[model samples]
Target chain A: MQFGLSDSQLLLKDNARKFFASECPMASVRRLMETGTAYDAALWSKMAEQGYLGIIFPEEYDGAGLGKVDLIVLMEEAGRALLPGPFFSTVALAGAVLSEAATPEQKKRYLAPLCRGEARATVAFLETGASWNPADVRVASANGRLSGEKLFVTDAAAADFLLVVAREGVYVVQTKAAGVSIELMNGLDLTRPQYAVRLSGTPAEQLGNSEGLARGLQVGAAALAAELVGGMQRTLEMTVEYAKTRKQFGKPIGIFQAVQHQCADMYLETESARSAAYYAAWALEENSPDAEAAVSIAKLYASDAGRTVGNRGIQVHGGMGFTWENDVHLYYRRAKASETMLGDATFHRERLARLVIDAHGALAKSA
Target chain B: MDLNLSADERSFRNEFRTWLEANVPRDWPEWREKPLEESFDYLRAWQRKLYEGGWAAVSWPREYGGRSATLMQQAIFWEEMARLEAPPMANALGLGLIGPTIIAYGTEAQKKRFVPKILSAEEIWCQGFSEPNAGSDLASLQTEARLDGGHYVVNGQKVWTSYGWIGDWCELVVRTDPNVPKHKGLTVLLLNMKSPGVEVRPLRQMTGESEFNELFFRDVRVPVDNVLGQVNDGWNVAISTLMHERGSYGARLHLLFKRNINRLIELSRTFKHNGCPAAQNPLVRQKLAQCYAEIEIMRLNQLRAFSRITATGIPGPEGSIQKLFWSELNQRVQQVAQELLGPYGQLAKGDLLAVDNGIWSYGYLRTRGNTIEAGTSEVQRNIIGHFVLGLPRSY
Candidate 1:
């Protein structure tokens, strides 16, 4: 009945923290975000060397066989470092779906290259409607050719392949294939660049069923929640540090009850989000009965908490927090973007309502 | 990372479940329907039955008449109690706060004298720490005790004393030295409620319940041997009791929130809203789902706290976090209840058309004190700020 990380998981977390602190610090993140791709190939390969690219894939696919919990541990560290690139889109989103849906042949062909960092992939889930629901997918594929647009496709510009969600099923499309074009979007979170991918009769291969895609979305939501937890945590630390040093009214602003309580509220939100995120990751790993509900809960709570902690973080920093020169705004931007990426709090809350109402409705009927 | 119970824990849970299924009073809910004062005998008897069944104080050491259960087993015990809707133990303060303090700081003689009675509900205990002047600033309390012969002559008053009216013993903190610092001059004494010049006046809360009282002590004498710890270190002793209150109440509170939420869900199905069942309303569903998520988070947060305690033999500042979250969350839940039930929610108990015997209304009022009692939300935030976040203490 323990709710703590295992010895190996703790080691993984510590090593990930140290790795990000050294390899992908805020300076490096800033440097990369200014670039068009907002990505560093060398950093990608280094993470691959560290086995993070395959942290959740099975060993049969030449990957490190770890669970969703382990993936979250890495994702959280990446989030703290604000590690700019396609790590989330490549590994957490696309990799999760591929691992869940791919056959041995498909996995060996696509997943192995991803594990080795030879290729990067991103999931093209949201359509013009900007809904995460698979049922909202309007892009149709006929005879393994897709012709439609996928919106808010994260890291699509940096990806070698795209997992396009179409009306038929999830399709794997080569990003450089004929009739496929990627245009970078004006994303608020510059750290993780997004792109609009337009596929016109693009040759593709069907990867998996909608059920598998749905399950993978849950994993993605949980993973994003973990990332949000990390962002919230770092924001809290930054806010607390700023409060301790930023003097106002002849004393550190932290000495004032107003500022102190705000910081405390940040701590509360961050910690609560962490609990939700970690539990979601564990539930998915264990195939717990509440895994679906837990994932939505995590995403819902983290989506709200991330924005809140960011707001408080900026508020504590006063003028400095509002400027691009300071790193606090970067976290704030990422929080806002991430809040809507998987499913915003409102979206997840409605999803949760469906789950709860349906379950209770069934129970009432059976009784 | 593993949340599944081990074989031993499962067996222990099963054993307790069996006992509870067989022994739990069938008419316990009926007893609860009576006034709080009238229900004491039933509650006390229930605790005694648990003691006789070897289920009382499962987390305490075996030498102290407990089963010496592991933390997981203790958690399972609470979970099962909630599952079965078992009556609450009459000596909750004795078992949860005073008894643990006695075990931590009591002499061997004190343990032998108090521990058994606490488990058996032979004696009920109340905390006498907060005074009128020392609600949040407890160190500023003026409850004074002067050493007289073989006893301490205590004076001054303690307000908001839970279970005071029926308490057999009082864990009283008094200022033993006025010359020293306010925090340094205090002492904790085990005072008999029957002592001369002691008074307990019922304090009616907004819920119309006299669950708490104002305790006045005009030279009430407490024996020297009744002092729980050192004479001038009552501050530390009281802190320990408060920590216990904050840290260990999570599991029980989780069950309570769970029960209330389930009831709310059931009512939402029957209650009308905008020409439909409230459960069918999109807004109400969102509110209920949010409450459900928070309640699940509460349970998970409790596990995290338990994990920390298991890893490190002391409760960390996470207790303050849980306290702050749950108190505010309860208020939110009650507010949602009002929104869902409308005017009927405001009906008092025994009202002809009151929903669920007006429990939602009672809860709506009772939960108002959750944030204010134990510690105010402001005080909790201060604790989290100073202790958890390393923020400078507010002046």
Candidate 2:
């Protein structure tokens, strides 16, 4: 069967590329990073106007009805642009959960504003310990009163709402609500700011049914995988370009087998990441039986590939790559942050191990 | 974007599955027993049966006695065969590589004479592109062929020729003009392996398999009509052959990797590590999980490359990307397998107390050739650097 982007998906990707190239180039990214703004409001509004915020949401909810693949296309562009903001936190993490978990009234009240970009939101899934397992949730919410701290929450300071993972289920709390305090963390990746939220008995509205949170995590992992693909791709391109121009000894560094092979390795990693992310997106869209396994595989590869390719990208750039003035480190920081954001490679690998063991057990019982 | 097979492709798979289920030897696993010659004969007969059943060359055109299947169909065919644990066709080199090249470049008469026998396993073929001196830089080959009235007198030595010991024909590349550039002066000829003054010396590998041989020719004569394409253009034909070899069989290789990982998983469940089952060990589990991820990457890479081919109607240098990934991935898989086996890793295949019949040891040793053969990983990186990334040539 055919297993590539359709003509329309290709068109969407190209348009997204052109949009990011013109609107959110690394120059603007660095500018935003310096000013300590979570994101550019003008660019976010422009993205909303382009209907990107609702690429995968239903039109009845003031959104587009495209599939997970279209979201992947957009997320990839966002990562390439290093668009500093709550796009992933707002649209991918929180939006996916709301779309799946929010009741008709809840969706009308919350998701409508999210799709229209009228309100920004982020999800706080990790406690002090950033465990990927839902069973490891330490936040407690009883009778709409939440008491727990969420660390490494992306765009927490900039969000109007926080979808906190509690022992009971998921709860939505206003960022400025009583007993809710948000502190911006001085993290490595300034492009996407991380914040630690301290909640002490904060009044929260319960999002009915925690069933969708697992799917939400899988969807987020898939989208993040797409973003990592973008970062890896740009890093590889930058490294290859630098190798072609940077001379060593006598000829261009690209002419040297050592540098050439390094770039080739980056090339391999980037391509593999792209394939893994795309397939995971497809699997999520189709609700394939292997979606859980596929999501973990994608995240695992993207994590490893992003870090390896980014580090190698820096290595290929020689002294320039080590300096902040060089853009290679920007990708490197983002890659590192994304690798540890939801869960690192080690976390996902263990999840995969469990899935494999469980499947083996099931097969044995049947036999 | 659907990964599942289309209806037609699924039907094609089902047809082959039915034929294979009924025809496959009941004692196929036992076929790998002592008396290697008898095993080879069994495999040859099985391939002939596949030919008669119309399942020998699924990717070949119908005019050449094949199903003329689409890329998806071809992939499904290979995947199914690998799942059934069927032996590779007796004339794999002939059917997979040289036959496609011949179809592309062979004269009308050449195709008529050569295509049918190749599918039927009547003619075994071996490639003679690499020489002792021209391993990676094949254009530097010193093999020479001079044209006479109706024949070309060839004198050359080729190494690492698979199936050379029993090959019926050799897809030999030679220098036809000494005055021109190395690449421009070459010619490709389908040489009769049984010709006078030809010698094949089987080379024992580290794995103890003599599947490859060294071929020496002293004035070996080949009919001028056996030349697939124009003289002095063998370099292009050789490149095409290499491309086909890499592009067409990726799905099959992916299944082979899958089968190996599955076996390794079963082995992990049984093998002991520190007085407990190795499967329960965190490190071993992580390693196995990594193997699964990498293998999946290999399969996805195949699908992406195959998609590009389907869209463009040509297998471009993008195919080189998968070639570079898979060869290295295969080595990594076998290396991990051997590491998991630990002390048993050193045991040869068919050893009395060996795990999985010591397949991991043999696989570990044999997989070294995956990177060096077809094209070295270094050469593959060069291709990606030059063609895919548009980097300047290192040379």
Candidate 3:
């Protein structure tokens, strides 16, 4: 058994890193975050040209026809660059949902344009309750019409369509459709803007069943976990660099054990998160029996590690880390936002607990 | 990226599993209940059985009485062993650390003489690196050995030597020259434990057992031929031993921690908290689930390390990452056990109501040494800081 990237996967990862480095540097990230929707059309088209927007979509849909591992590899690179846009919402969230649930006709009409960068889409899953559990969904769709408020809907303002998760099933609704209201919320993560979407009798079409939506959420969680790993890695590099150069009394502050041990912890957490996230992606790609538990494990571990690495990163940088001018805060903000996005640590841990309990119960019964 | 076992590996696993199912001592659970000293013979016989089946030291080279198995096979070996709840071999230090060091640095005669016996558990081994004065700063050890008439006259003490009393030989590191740097003046010798003037005094650990000892060497003479490597170059040899310790310990620990966690989960199902099973408590479930994730991460991290070694032909600094993680993760796992079991967890092994025969209690105390032994977590961090991150050494 090999636990590393294959030659092609490595090449894809390297090319993606180089592509993001040139196309979506932190400077561009900052420039775009200041915009109204934090969505750059040119960057979105460039990503589509790279086939990232359709990395996991099938060839029939004019896509790259890659797998989940490939998607995470590209997502990790985008995360490292702090790529600001509707990419994650469009590709990782909405694209995954459509790929998992959409009919062939739906794929041709909706997923194909998303693959070609002609449209943007995102999932509107959370409502007033703000819970990730599909069972907690309160949005109602009746008579092919949606009438509910979806809070913290990622990139809804920038999306051409919204995959609104309703009590009946997932529904597709146009963002600019009559009776649709989208207001961009002040989000902690500047790079990925969230919005409140209000639907009053908006015409919607049911996309797929609850089973497909659940599968899509798992894919999204694993992808976000990979993204968090990238953010943690970059934060670690920045912190370690600052520690080596930033002198305190007589030597570099890194020479101090207090600083060095914390840096070690950061390195440990970042590497561990990478392991968990990559394994989750591989598990999902393989459709392994452990895929559900692996996804929760990845999301749970990365959610905590992302915040911790950010905390330690800022701590090691001392006062400079606190400045709005420093890029460290940007990663810190992203980590904080991502921590709670696709089910926070507490949420996933509880989910894992149930899975473990059921498996053990099954074992006991068999025995 | 492929974690699926190849056909060869799968066949190897099946072969080993069959052998183990047939040969594993059916009385291991009772044998494990015996004191450490009383179980040596049983463990030795187990190791011999493994040796006879050619299952001992699967990762060692073919010439050294091993299958010359791939790293994945070695991992599979450990996994199957844990799965069957097989008894541990008598010569853990030997198989894990000393034999590998000998394979790397020992002379042709040395490998021929020592390697097979280690696998057969004929000559159990213990490392003699840490002195009373040299715990973290191990290179500063002052255990001196002077060359005299083709023999090294050793006169120093080694502390915290595991299996010191039972070991047939010692992989001893000693200072050969006082005029040079502490690190440069060292030499490693394969000293027979039965040598004249050598004394082993049992040191009781916090667990109320003398599983280790303080070894006193009063002018113990070692033949010059017994030196494992070149004179005054024992630092690198000893470092190789420590590297071997960190390199593969995670796979072993994974099975062990897995057992403990499984036991904890079972206990959580029975133990009551707030008028319900502890497993029903949200806080307990969260803790258990977190520990579960951490343990899984530990396994994945080990695989990552193994993948790197398989590619590079040498263990990388990532071993330090595994070392740092599992040591602390085990501690957290134990703490969660105590939290779930409550007051019953504090009972000793002989106590009537002790949980899991007080294994958790013993583990809680014994694992305090995990981070301290092999290398302290602080020492590991220092290594990661200097080696992995290229930071300036704190010292």
Candidate 4:
């Protein structure tokens, strides 16, 4: 019922916000942009040591055993700070997927080490031109082998392991495993290092059957939505700051009626994104029957809002905002990339249309 | 740093949420039967209840018997409580505005006496800043304060003070010198609202509430002890309180939207134009979608403000951004509610079968005050553009 966060959740969130504000600032991130690697390995490890890497998993599996809502809180702060790493994928997708689909033995093997931040993993699910269709699994996981390509994988270049979804089922593919090839791409947001990974008959451990893949993908999508919720928070903050400090026409541009109105609009987008994200995360935690639909709605709005708020950030910053040195670009790129990560707003809208159309039998609600 | 909450803070948040769920009902009271005075009483009683429960001053200092909760915690309290559509509380003309100002600049006696009363809503308060001619140019106010033997005599008129008529006291700005810049030679005073020679004329607003007031002062006299800060230092004090006030009230954008949840549900259930539920209409759906999106961003901005406050101890001028962002959102969201009903929306409150029983019409009229009330939207953008973003300010 707490639409936002609990008091204790706020404490954790503030701690994370303070840590990132001081430790992984935009200045530090800008300094590391061309470093080719997104994350500060030592810092990432420290984050892991803090149990952020396994925020939502089971305590028995060495997790904090906090709910996904709590992780959503951290993820938002992480987004606010633009903490450069494989955090979104590792904490959000891999950990959540394993929790949803993995056997107890699998959780003991992956979730515990992952929670402790000793190992980093990501989901390799979508192929080129395929974004939101979790059922679009052409890559096959059969006969103890995995083969398929996952494009636009965030931080795949620096990952220790990859959890790949395939036609037969879900497969665990290590970055260094045999028959696996990775091409590090020039990402829009250097903070979130992305990759083009091609796996051909890679030695893989199959986690579950096709049904399991379905379940894992849903978890991953929901996690992505939650991660996006975080990113949108950062976008709004950065833009607001930019609006305050950036000046044009002999005074601060935010003082202008037009600019302030635009900022307000952006704020609205980010606010809606927050609600959607929180509701989605909360639903998952509550085990609501409507969790899937809520997750879809959350992801859809967040992706759209990520782009809107991210762009508005630049608008608020104006010229200096468009420059490469500003942290605004960090959020901007992330928003653009993330908007289409699991799916675009339109894609989610289509998905939502399908849901309502199916569940209630098509009432022509679209107009 | 982890984003987990401390067990106690978590408990505080849950308890607050529970309290709001149980005690603070957000339904707009019966307008005619429950007038603005009644509304004020409702709020005052609720504040005392919360103050007794020790939830009233979520962000005030501990010395004042406030919980002085972290910024994020305060924000979390507001956000969660707002989501429940909780009924109004005795808001912080004192706690958020005067209390923080006094903390920063008040004499020990002033702090000891006024702060507690403000927290407990023991005395209702209002601001006497804007004169008929000195709104955006508040520094240009001609409300004169002449220093007499051990007392200051004030003569002036102030307008548009919300929650003003029934207030027990007034935190006001008065001019002490005319031979200086507009912003200089000013003083802030704490005068009894019921003081002799003080008149309060309530202004009924579109929302069927007389939340705004016009105050007239004729030789209002108060001891030197009533001074808030240094003589002729009212501008700085006012600025500080205004910032805190902005931050506190900036959550209004989404808070108002959340209050409309029932209205939205009703509009969805009944506002028919072509045949389908207005909610089913794609345009209305789009409006809802857009409204939903804007609400999310407002929430995120709110979270950012809370996080910043929690992390930094005192929120900086960035509070202006939240203020600016929210004021405009309130304006737009209310517009959506009105437009959702088409021509039927044109019906005023008394019209039959009016949209949401004409609640939205009241809302639309009331929402007009959003951008205007807490500094005009134009001024807010200027603040954000000039102060926060370093953008050019419109003259």
The most accurate candidate by DockQ is 3
Regions of candidate 4 where Cα sits further than 4 Å from its true position? A1-99, A104-206, A209-302, A309-334, A346-367, B1-33, B37-124, B148-151, B192-210, B217-225, B250-256, B269-273, B278-312, B381-395
How is the predicted docking of candidate 4 categorized under the CAPRI scheme?
Answer: incorrect
In order, what DockQ does each candidate have? 0.73, 0.69, 0.74, 0.15
Q: Which ten-residue region of model 2 chain A has the weakest summed lDDT?
A: A358-367
If scored against the real structure, what TM-score would every candidate get? 0.98, 0.98, 0.99, 0.68
Quantify all predictions' global Cα lDDT against the true fold: 0.89, 0.86, 0.90, 0.73
Which lDDT tens digits does candidate 4 get at residues B155-231? Answer: 98999997786688888999988788878899899998877889889877666667789999899898888998888
Model 2 iRMSD vs. native? 1.9
Docking class of 1: medium
- How would you encode candidate 2's per-residue C-alpha lDDT over A1-367 as one tens digit per residue? 8879888888999999999899888788888887664577898889899898888889988888899988988899888877788899989999999988878789888888988988899899887667867788988977779997898999887789999988888899998899999988899999889988999989999887678988987889999999999988888888888888988787789988888889888889988888888898898898887788888899999999999998889888999999989998998898999998778888888888777653454222211
What lDDT score goes with residue B54 in model 2?
A: 90
DockQ of 4: 0.15
**CAPRI band for model 2:** medium
lDDT of 1: 0.89
